[model samples]
Each structure stands twice: as structure tokens, then as C-alpha cells.
Target: MLLLLASLAFVQYVRTSSSDQNPYLMTDYSRLHPVKVERVLQGEAEAQLIGLVKDAKAKGLKLSIAGQRHSQGGHTYYKDAVVVDMTSYNQVLSVDPEAKRIVVQAGATWEDVQKAVNPYGLSVKTMQSLNVFTIGGSISINAHGRDIRNGSLIKSVESFRLLTAGGDIIQVSRTENAELFPLALGGYGLFGIILDVTLILTEDEVYRESTVLMNLEEYSDYFQNEVLPNPDIRLHIARISVAEDSYFKEAFSKNYTVDRSLKLSDHNKLKSNDNWVAPGKLLFNINRSTDWGKNAQWNLQKHFFVEQSDKIVSRNNAMRAASAFMEYSQPGANDLLQEYFIPLPQFDAFVQRLGAIVKEEDMNLLNITIRYVNKDDEAVLSYAKQDMLALVCLFHAPLSKAGQQRMKQGVERIINEVIASEGSYYLPYIAYPTLEQFRNVYPGYEYFFAKKKDYDPDELFMNYFYEQYGG
Candidate 1:
């Protein structure tokens, strides 16, 4: 058996302008203590994967699988572990359109398989912002988009080929290995390495999209009543104001343009240079972060086909953005992110308190991002439950260490408040929460730890996450 190791040392460099210092935010890591892994096992089938697993066991090298390494958590990369780089295994095994299913190698990214099925006039129902994440990686984390109707990407999976810790090849689905199926959805690659997956694809359709800026006072209503109820409304988000008059009235006059109106909504929420607009607004306001008001025009389009090819391109762009994005989750109204996953029944109250938190905190919120997701049963830790999930990312910039500390402290407070109210924080981008906070955030963590131990008993697949959570 040949061993292949693609050294990751070359991509490490200090990029000062970047947002997140963590390597998990990028394909490469520079800050974390540089650890070298002997990358082995290039590509294989169930039998072949089993053989490799057996070989690793014989060599006494605890092994870990590598996909796109897009996860923000450190689960995908290691310092001195034996890694199986699955990228070489990229392949679309089969596409059974008659059954509305597609089989693809675990190493393949969404961009890979989506393009393969383009001619078939099919598309994936849901996807995260980036396309570079592998099918296995996303399934491991149980990632989902802002769309409420479409929950985690794993829900589309009909079945999977799993290479377990015992070096056994097993077929798992809602029935076969049923308990492990949903368990693995957000399992974080602790139980087994996915060899391949069969996903149910959706028919192609067009999307009508738009971005509107509304006042903070109306933020809760807009999200709960309008944004949450509509599935056709693909991506909906709100950016809040942190600074005074940061939303320059003259800037809006200069930048606001409706490029393609019919394709998107005519909704343009702008506060003209009216009394509401103040100086220093751009520096302090949440809306100033995106500065949508600064952009003279917004793209609006309708009847645009959601073809597989088109989605592939969009997903690729999402990856580029993900790679380049400086670490900032969307900002919310009160200078903080009071995100919550209120059951649909409690949405009304959720919004009301959401606004009150911002006000009481004296946080000048600009826009609140409103994301809708279908109730999904993928990951035990996933935020996709019975209600629409809303993430309020509050931003305050020229980010002084003291100010950041204050904001982060406030964020912790808000997170605690939400958890007390039965909400979970989005774990990927979180930077300051403690292990106890993490435990509270995901009550199913005990099960997650058990799965990790069952598969990676030796703990060779280690990272900062394992050390922090003791998982």
C-alpha cells in the first residue's frame, strides 16, 4: 500500500488583516502550534477503506479522516496524527434520477456532485454558504443554510457507506444502523468515516431574491411575520447599526440602485439623511458593517433557474467568501447578538424580548438577520428545531480590546440568557464561550463524547477542541 501525504505546512502565514485567527476558519492554519500529520490513504472503496483501516491499526497509528477541512472546530486537522486525506477519492459514483437520488464519494465537495447532475435538471435542496466543504464534513457538523424550509444538508441523505472503527463496511440509513444515522448527522466524524453517500435531489426551480433594510423597532415583526413564513424567500438577513448616522444619507442617495427589480423585492429600507441619521453613524452602527446603504444599488432578480450548474457556481462563490471572510457573524440591534431558536409558537415573544435585550443593553442595533429553517432531526446539537432560527450578530468596531471584551462579555451574558430560555448558540463562529457554556449549548454532548470514544478510543485524532471539551 502506498502512503500519500500532502504537507499543509506551506499555507501557514500571518495574515494581519484577516478576521479569525483560527486555522479552522481557513483551509490552512497558521497560528495554532504547527503539528505535522503523516497524511496517508488516498482513495478506496469499502473493501479498500477497510484494508487501510486495518493497516493503520497494525501500525499502531490512530487514524483520522480529512475532508475539505472547512469546519471551524478543530476536528478536521491535527498536529501529529495519521490523517486519511479523502480529496483524492473525489468521484460521483452514480446518479439515479428515476429514484431522485445521487451517490457520491465522501471526499467530493458539493460543487463536485452538483455540477455532475446539472444536465439532469436537478439541484440540492439545501447547502451552507460555501461549496468547498465536503459532503462528509458538512454531514459531520450537520450544517444548514439560513433557509427555514431547508434544514441541515444531511437531511437529503438517503443512505451512507460507513467505515467503522472495527474496520467494517456498513450501510446505514433511516432503517439500517438507524440510530447511528441521525446520530452521525452532526456526529463530527467520531463514530466512523463516511465512504460514500446517497442523497435525494430536488427538481430544478427558479428563486426570487432581495435584501431590504428595515428599522430596528420593526426588526422582530419583519423576521417572524415576513421572513420566517416564506420558503420561496431563499436568503434573508438583517444588519444592525452600531454607530450613529453611520448609515450616511448621502451615501444611500449615491449607492442605492435596484439593478434587476423584478428578480428581487422592491423593498429598500433606508433612513434618509433624516433626523434619525447622525454623524459617527458609519463607525458605530451595525448597518455600517455591510454598508448596504453605502452600495448605490442592490441586485434583484426573479425567475432565475436554480439549475445544478447554477447552484454549483453560487456555492463556489460561497466558498471563496468563506475563505476570504474576516471573522464576523451578522450583527444585531443591541450592540450584541441575542440569537434564539424559539419554537414557532414562541416566535412572537422571542422577537419582543430580542428587541428588549438590545434596548436594555443600550446596544444600537441596525439590522437583525432573519433565517428560516425547516424543523430537522439531523444533529442532536443542531439549532434546527420546531421554530425559525434567528441569529442576531451585534457588531461594534474600531474594535478596542476593552470594547471587544465588553461586547464579548455581553455576548456571553446574552448566550447564557438565551440558553436559560432554551436556545442554543451557533457553535461554529463562537470564540469566547467556556466548556460549561458549550455543555449547556449542546445537551446531547454526552452522546457525542461516547460516539467519539467508540470510534477513536485511542484519542489519536486530537485537537484543541478535544482538550477543551475532554471529548
Candidate 2:
């Protein structure tokens, strides 16, 4: 099986003033496009970068920013732009255990935050499955994890410092500069550079992991009836079987509930990611090509996660995002990701139609993970306008010109289906939808872009995403 491990080590780049780097070759996690830029800052101090921002504003040069570059598409890059690599500036500012809050430089990753707050017996309210993503990137995407009650990163944010296009550092929170809060929170770095972030933390309690099997039809009801009613459960997620017989017809749910009977130990009990690297990579590589391999992976996971899902672990340990399958680049293939946010009532219809599309398109469908999101009314270009299911689809596609063209056509059908169900597909993914389709799904985009003019009159913070759909 092919292994593409996600790198946590900082990238080393030579900051040379050479013309050869012009399409500024940089790629995000997708490995789909290694783009070109006018210049990329590899070893510049924060002050120097801010000066660069001012210099860009003065010379009318396009400027962009990236932290870890984990975003899928050009969410981190723009053609002919000066991209600021922000990871070097990352540092924990302070931690207030009594208030259950911590402040850190935006470029700090969740892994950094966990280490800081864990000593206080606190945990992050929510974060992506893995700890490799930078906090700034997470806030820009408004990322959410298994904690359904808290909703998204926005729910945990207290405030942050944003550097606007004019190179002015401004404080934005629910109060005082209130309008800027939502814009910066999920603004996709279009508004400004997040200098720092203050996030609310939670107790690192012991949670017992358990799994339940149910047909697709019973998911929503079962969630509302059994999952939501319990206060002990903190994390909930389910997998849709990709096997030929079950094929979205069946699902296995995993719930992590706080165990009062146990207390979290004074240690991180997670096995070294190396422990699961081989099996995890093999399972996904097989799931990419064979139904038998896919079924085998499911059965194997079921035996460990379902048959005796009663294992107890610390909240901090339960949330590590180190699975090898969800790692970095594939040499000859691309791990394409497309997420759809369907209205709660439309979940059943949406999934059924989606399954049909997969069958009809013969998509190399590997896995579908379900998550609950509450209405994110604050973000200007909010995906979760109401409670909905976020379906994260990860699949393998050949890295060829034809494969990209095929992916474009296939994702179009997916966008239409989501829109037809009164749902909107998430941005920060494949730039397949036209501006018309984008506006149709996100009706408030016009107002959002309009507001951008007030803050960024010259339109300095631009990316491939806005270039494709921000009409």
C-alpha cells in the first residue's frame, strides 16, 4: 500500500529573488495543484511581513497568506501574489485555566494548543481530526469536529487580532468591531491575516467510546432520540459503508461519552501514530481500488470499534488526527475531497440521491463521514445557515488531465444535487462550480463581497477560490 505521511515539521524554503519560481509552485493537502506565485516569504519576521503587506498595498501588488498550507485548493495561494508563510510566528501567548481560555498566535497548531492547555486539565472544545492544522487556518475555515453541542470553532472563539489590507491591526470580537468578528472567523483569509486567536477550552474528561449499527433511514431519528438526549456524550460520528451490499444502506455510529466512573490520567495515552500507520494506509489504499478491501476494512474496524466499543480514554487522546489514511500526497493519484451541507430535513433525500449519483457516476467512492452542524449565522459566507449534516467525501482520482476533467463533471452533478435539496456545498474544496452556482447556493455572497470593499478597497487579499466564484 502507498503511504503519504502528513508532515508536521516546518517546511524549509529558500527565499531567493529568482524569476523561475513564478507560478510560485505551492500545493495544499490536495496535491492537485502546485501553484506559482511572484514571491513566497520563507524566513521573514512578523514585522517584516506586515511591512511587506504595506508595501504590497502601496505598489498595488497582490498579496496572500498561508499557515501550514493545509487548505485543499488555493484557499492559501493566489496567482502572481506574495504569499506570507505564517507558521514561523506561531507561539502560545497565554493560558487562563480558571477562565478555561487560552490565547495563542494564529499560526500555532491545535497540537500546540493541546500541549499548553492539557496541563490545566482542559481540552479544545472542537478541532479537526488531526492536530497538524494551524489555528489560524482552522478559524479561517471555521472548522468543526465531533462535538455537536458546541457547533464550530466560532462558538469557542472569544476574539482575535486581524491585520487588514492597509496593515492595520484591529481587535475583533462579538462586541467592539463586532462586524469584523464573523468575517474574520470564517472569512477564508480574504478579509485579513489573523494575528492571534483566543479560544474557550473544555475539561479533559474521560470518555468511553462505543459504536452502534443502524440503517441509513434511522440515522437522524436515532441521533435526535438517543444521541442528543444524553449530556455525557461529547463526540459523535458515523461511517457509511462502501461495500457492494450495504453501500450507504448501513452505517456504524461511534459515540464518545464522558465516564464519571473514571478520571483522566496525567498522561497522553495515544499510541504512536507509527503503530497504526501500516494498517491504516493499507485499508485506505485498498478501499480506493477494491470493494473486497473496502468491506474488509469495515469489518476489521467493526470488530475493534463495535464488538467491544467500551474502551475508556482521555478526551485529549480521543481527538488526535494522526490516521495515516488521512495523510499527505499520493504520487500518481489525488485524494479529492468534497463536502456538502444538507438541511436536516433534506438529509434522507440528499444521501439517497448522492448514493445514486455515486452508482451512476461509478465514482471511486471510498468513505462518507457524517457530522452535525448548527446554524452559523455569524459568518458572512456561512455554509451552516441552519442545522445540517456535513458529508465529507474522500476518494482517489488519477493524477492526469483527463482525471481532473472527469472530476469537474462529476462534482457538478453533486453541487446540483445539494442545491436541489435546498443545501449548499462547502467552499475551500474543488473549484468546480461556476459563479452562478456559487451565488445560488450562497445568496449572501454579494453582500459579503460588497462589505469587503469597505475594508479592502483595492481587493488585496485574493485567492483561487474568490477568483473562481467571487463575482
Candidate 3:
């Protein structure tokens, strides 16, 4: 019944933290902004930073709130605005093992929550690709990792504490503020700033996972139907490996029972090779491949391991068996990536068209990744509504001339096709597409704006996306 610490102490901290660092250096992660603000709040009262809220509204200044700065899109960063740094507010408010719920402050990172719930033999239903991200940030963006069984992380949120534009503090849930709850779920922080979130946790169990190398033609059906149906299976990632005339696919899954029919010997041979390295590291070598055709090869990595429900564990190691990692793309790479989540029926055709394009253009298809997601609650901009989703991430290492050309043309053509298919691009990885293309992807941007207007009429909370698309 106890709530996290009250908000009074947090504002004072925010007031002081603002002075510790130069406001010029403060950023929301993606879009850097030069602004003046009181301070970044920490602790329970962060949710109720009435003074900061009042100040921003009083000056009719736009305010931007940030947790971990993990979002790839321009959703978090703002310029010449009051930025609420929420990192100091990290804390586990409470946990109810019997009810399978855990309350956490908005600033709390996934790492913090995972540790707190470990003792309860519980874990979140889903998490982002990385654990360093903050809980509230995940909910705002509606993030998801490789898990196809669950939708995005928003589905796990049972309720949240939010501060509205009017400076009103309220707790939101499915049963309470029902309409606004789902609206703000994937609403991209348009409704208000998330102060805290309570999520439903799953009982821990042994995760039998494995990685497999297959071709596009080989596992398209399995990805759409089999893996997405089981709620227990975690982390389904498919990456297209561009090697010479042959193209191979790398697929990873967690807590899965190995299929006896699969060629165990072949799967073992592939994993043993150095081909299975971490994704970030693979970025450096992705351009080394000689041939760039649309053919398919799949490298399968599966893990069949079990651990007690209550042990603090590592999700990064569990998410991917490889050790290669990469940073966010720098500004202005000639190449671009276009990802579309079309209806399952269009999936096969989409891939076929992509293959044809790769062949016709002689494009160096870097890596094509396909991810599956179950249907989610209604949100006008929700990308997971499709019965199944195939996220095709084509890599183009602008570091190389050929890679840059291939990526540029490939992204442009792919975006055109996606628009034609009535499919949308994921904001996180979007590097191309015109404003018109973006507007088509999010026709509900106006709806989001209306809601924001009602909550923070003064536009105290603002970001690059807000200025560009918030209307």
C-alpha cells in the first residue's frame, strides 16, 4: 500500500542538478537542445514537481522530459525548452509478488526493476533491445525487444502515475482513466509526462533458447505463425547476412524447445564458426562480404537454459548470443533503412519484391531483419496491430562507397514501396522519408496533438518531434 517517496524532495534535487552541469550540455538523447530549466528531479516527488511544472506553464515555455535518452527517434530531445531530467528519480516504489505487480518511478531503469523483481521470482512480460533504458521511457515509446510472443513493453504496464499539462497529478490504468490509458500507451509521450509505472510481471522459468541460420524462403512461415503464438517464448531476432552470391539469415530465440526434425548437426556447425559474433561488432565486418545477392542463409542460435525465478540475471547476454554491438547512426549517411510492418498476407510478396529490387539494382543488401508481434490494444499510431510484423532492417555501411550508394537508393525505393503498401516505418530507425511520408505513417498525429493540447496547453513539454509533427 505504500507509494514511492513523495515528490517534494525531487524538485529540490532537480533545482540543484541543473546547476551541477551546464544546461548547454543537457540532451534528451537524440535531438540536442540548448535550454534553461530549473533542475532534473529524482525520487518520489519527481512525479509531482509542481514548481517546475508551474514555472514552465507560467512562462508558456515548452518542457521536455527524458529518462535514459535511449530512443532513436527525435521523441525525447528539445531545443530552447525547459528539460526535466528524470534520471535522479530512479527507485522501486513497491512490489506485490502475490498480485504480480511492481511499481517503479519514471526514472528507474529496466536494470533497477529487474533486480527488484528478481527476488519475487518475477520479471517483466517484455523489455527493449537493451536494459539500460528507463521504464517510463519504454512505456512512452511502447518499446519491445526480440520477443514475438508479447507485443511491445506497453502491454505489461498495469498502471502509471502521470502529470498532465494542467499540472494535475493522476494515476492511470485500464480500469481507471480507461480511454486515456491506452491512448497514452503508445501515444509517444503526447498525453503527458510519465511519473511512474506499475507493470505486471511473469513468474520466472527456465529459458530454453537456440539460434538458427536459415534462408528467407526457409523460415518466413515459422516466424509469422509458430514463434509468435507461444507466450512463453522470448526474443525472436532475424538478421540478413550479406555474403557473396548467397545471403544467409541469423535467427535467435529464447526459452524454446529444440525441434528434433531440424538438422542439429548443421545448426551446430554454423554456431561453432566465428560467424556468430555480437551484433555491434558485426557492423565493422558487414561490409567485408563479397557477393551481395538476395539469396538466403540462416544461422540459428538457441539457448535451452533454466534459472531460478528470483535471481538477478543479465538480459543482454540472454537477448543475443553474439558480442557485436553498434552505436546510433551519425547525422547524414547517404544510405537509409526503411522498415515496414505490413499484414501477414503481404509479407511473402513484400520479401519477394525486396529480393527482386536487390537483384535488379545490384544493391548490396546489408542485413534484413524481420520481427513478429502480436496484435495490441488500439492506438491510432500503434504499429503492432498487424497479426504479424516483419521488420526489414537493411544495413548500408556508409563508411564504404558501394555501401553508401546501395543504402541510399535502397532506402528511397523501399520507402516508396512501404508507402504504396500502406505500411508505416518505425520511428526509432527512420533516417529517410519526407514529411509527407511521415504524415502518411502517422495520420493520427493530429489526434495526438489534440490530446496534448488538453493536457499541456502551454506546451510546457516539447521535443523535436513535437515541433515537427505535434502541430
Candidate 4:
């Protein structure tokens, strides 16, 4: 009883400290870190980058870049930085259906790119599950999605145009200006302003949807024996229910495999089966506030969502944004995100430990979605150091000091577990992890910073995430 009281007190302390430190109420989704910017800029042409950089330099102001601002961390802005809002200038520059390549303005949303390329029967090679995210934002974070074969965005990118802090626009690819490629891909917008990117596209695949129920222990072997071996399966994801009846033991796997019976033309003729906007957005809002909401969501998924026996979809339709596109928030409460990549072999162990921390702590964990990530050494600060399971969690926390502290403690515990498993946590969400934890997860920080200096010697391009860890 005493410990519980102390825990509540600490949570209140954390919320108070966070509120005191964050002076402004304006922030991204998490509402955890609020920052004031000198000014914001928007433009429709590449020429705007030159003036934005020059003006910031002339005024001795720091620069921060923003897209749709979906990232939970203060990575979208820094205190007193000049924010460049990239959404209005969005445009799809080029689409080559035959060659499977696309050139898009940095701010173009995946939905914009999709609308342009869908007619040609082509699809993005890799991206986040959402279509509302900007192309540049996705590339900047090196986002990944259901396509296990495609890996991260770095794997699909052919090249990109970067506007340096000095206002020089340069093209970067694997062989041309190679070092800049990895740095900017996942640099969290600390290196340069992304102007445009050329990425690989794929022929839209017709897929048959399916799901399977599995216990937590059977996941690793099932993934190895059932998921990976099937070449026909193109998109895969998993969900483990956190309800009282299921907890960590009950789970379901979702997959989309090539539908051999359907021709590309045949798919084009089919009507859109679902928008996924209404149900997806509805459930997302419910999860933001109550325990019953979370359980209700899983109940629906278990009973209704997992019943997919032979639903078919085009690759683009399958890739459409669902839950991630929702823009909902509850006052005095924040939706927080944490992601950890546990090495594949340590999957079961990681889950068991995770269960204890979450349950014992009684964290307001609202959602847990898992994905497979192949080994990726492409990004300098790569989270996938080894083949791993990317477990993404969404938690709802009250604005009270105690709630915030509880969240902080929960995040730290998860981070420690990930580190002990020889894995790494993602940097795009939450500011709870320590600078030391950042260094520990991404040992290449010094090297990445050194390379960053070559392009941004003035340290002009920055966000709260970089300002915290780049030191």
C-alpha cells in the first residue's frame, strides 16, 4: 500500500515537472514537449529552401522542419527554431510505371503519390502503413510497414535532393554523395532539408487476406516456420490482445498473400471493399481515454477482425492508412508511443519480461502491434541492428504529474529490457529515454554527428530529439 502511494506520488511529480518544463500547450500528438518557434514558413517550390536557410542564418536562428507532425517526440520542432511546414508544398513530380520509379516533392503525402501512380498499376515499395504521412517525413525517419520483403524506406529509396544548411542543393544516392544518404534517411531532420526524393515502386500485387490465432510462446516458431517461408505473402502484421481474458498469451496474426486467381486488370475492376476510416478512427479515439475502451477494441478485433478468410485487395488498398491517420486527442490526457526492436531469438523472453513490467506497473497500455524487421545497417542510427521483432506500443496517460511519472518509469523499464536483449529502441517517439540510452542503442552517434557536421556545421537543422541526444 505504501509503495503504491509512492508510485502515484512520483507520477504526479513527473507530470508537474513536464508541465513546468513545457511552457506552451501546442505540441504534436504526445503533447509531452511543447516548444515555441521563431516563425513558420511554407512554400510550393524548391527555391523556398534557399531563402529559408539564408533568412535563418541572417537572423542567427535555428531551423526545424515539420510535415504532418505525427511523430510523438518533440522531433517536429525545437525551442526557438524556425519551423518549416512542408505540407502545403506537396506535389508528385514524376511517375514512371514501366520503370517502377517515382520522383516526388519532399512534402508529398503517400496518398498523393498513390493517386498519381495507382492508375499505372504501381505502388510504393515501402512506407509506413499510413498514407497521410509526407514522403520526406517517412524517408527522414526511415519508416517501415507491412511489406516485410521491402525492409525500411532506405531500401526502397533510389535517390533524393537535399538542401543543406548553407542553402546548397545536392543529390544523394548510394553511390553519389553516398555518405549523406544514410545520414539524412534517418537523421531526424538534423542534417538537411529534404527537397525531393526518388524512390522505388512496385507492381501492385493482388492479395488474399488471412489471420491465425496463436499463443505467445508459439509466435517465434510460427514466424519462422509459417510466416517467413511463404514467398507469396507480401504484407504481414500481428496483434497481441491486452484484455483480461487474453493478456499476453492470446494473439492473432494477419497476412496478405498474392491472390493467384486475380489478374492485375481484374483487381482494378473490383470495388473498394472498405475505407477503414470510420471503424479505425472510432476505435482509436476510444483507446485514448479508458480501459474499457481498450478491451472493447480487442474484443471487436478478436471476434470480427480475425475472421478474414479470403478477403482480397490490391497492394495499394492494403497499404492504405487505417488507425494511424486518426487525429484525435483528449484534454488533460496524452497518447504516448514507444517502440522497441527485440532480436528475433529473444522474442519470447522479451515478451515475458514486457508482460511483467506492464502488468506490475499497471501502465495504461492501449495498443501493441508487432512487425518483423530484417537486419538493416543502412541507417547510421539504425534501430534494427539484428533481425528483430518491432513491438510498437501506444499508451494513454493523464496530464496529472503522477500519470506522467508513471509513463516515464514504464518507458525506462521497457528500454532497459530492450538493451539487455541486445536490441534497440526507436528514436522517433517519446523523450523519456536518457541521453545515455540513446548512445547505448545507437553507438554510431559520434560518427553520425561528425558526418552531420560536414553538411550542417552551423547546427542549423534541429529538433528537440536531436538537441537532446546530438550532444
Best by lDDT: 4
| Pairs with backbone N, CA or C atoms under 3 Å apart (clashes), candidate 2 | 23-36, 23-37, 24-36, 24-37, 129-321, 130-321
Angstrom error of the Cα, residue 331, model 1: value is 24
- Best-to-worst order by TM-score is 2, 4, 3, 1
lDDT of 2 by residue, 1-471 (tens): 233321211110111112222243766666666767788875245687678889998888887779887677688887788887788779999999999999998888888998898778899998987788899999998998888888878989999988889888888999979998887787888898888899999888888889998898999788888988898888888888887868888888889988787767644454344465645665666677788978887787778778988877788877884665445343567678889998878899889988888888777877889988878878888889888888989867776788877777788898998889998887877787767788998888887788787888898998877777663
Tally clashing residue pairs in candidate 1.
39
Alpha-carbon runs more than 4 Å astray in model 2: 1-24, 266-274
Error of model 3, residue 195, in angstroms: 0.8
User: Which stretches in model 4 have alpha-carbon errors above 4 Å?
Assistant: 1-26, 269-291, 324-326
lDDT of candidate 4? 0.81
Q: RMSD of each candidate?
A: 11.0, 4.8, 10.8, 6.7
The residue-by-residue lDDT of candidate 4 on 1-471, one tens digit each, is 545544553453444334323444347767765767776778567776798888888888998889988887888887788788999878888888788999998889988888888888888888887687999899889998889887888999999998888888898999988989999998888888888899899888799989888887898899888889999999998998877667888788888999878887777542343454444555556555566767887887877657745677888888874553244444577667788899888889999899889988888777888998888989998988978889988777776778888888888888899899999998888778888888898999999988877777888887778777774
Ranking by lDDT: 4, 2, 3, 1
lDDT of 3 by residue, 265-372 (tens): 233211111232333233333342443222222221112111222212233234323322233333323223446777776766676676666667666555666676
What TM-score, to 2 decimals, does candidate 4 have?
Answer: 0.91
- How well does model 2 score by local distance difference test? 0.80
For model 3 the local lDDT of residue 259 reads 38
Per-residue error (Å), model 1, residue 405: 7.9
Best by TM-score: 2
lDDT of 1 at 371: 54
TM-score of each: 0.68, 0.92, 0.74, 0.91
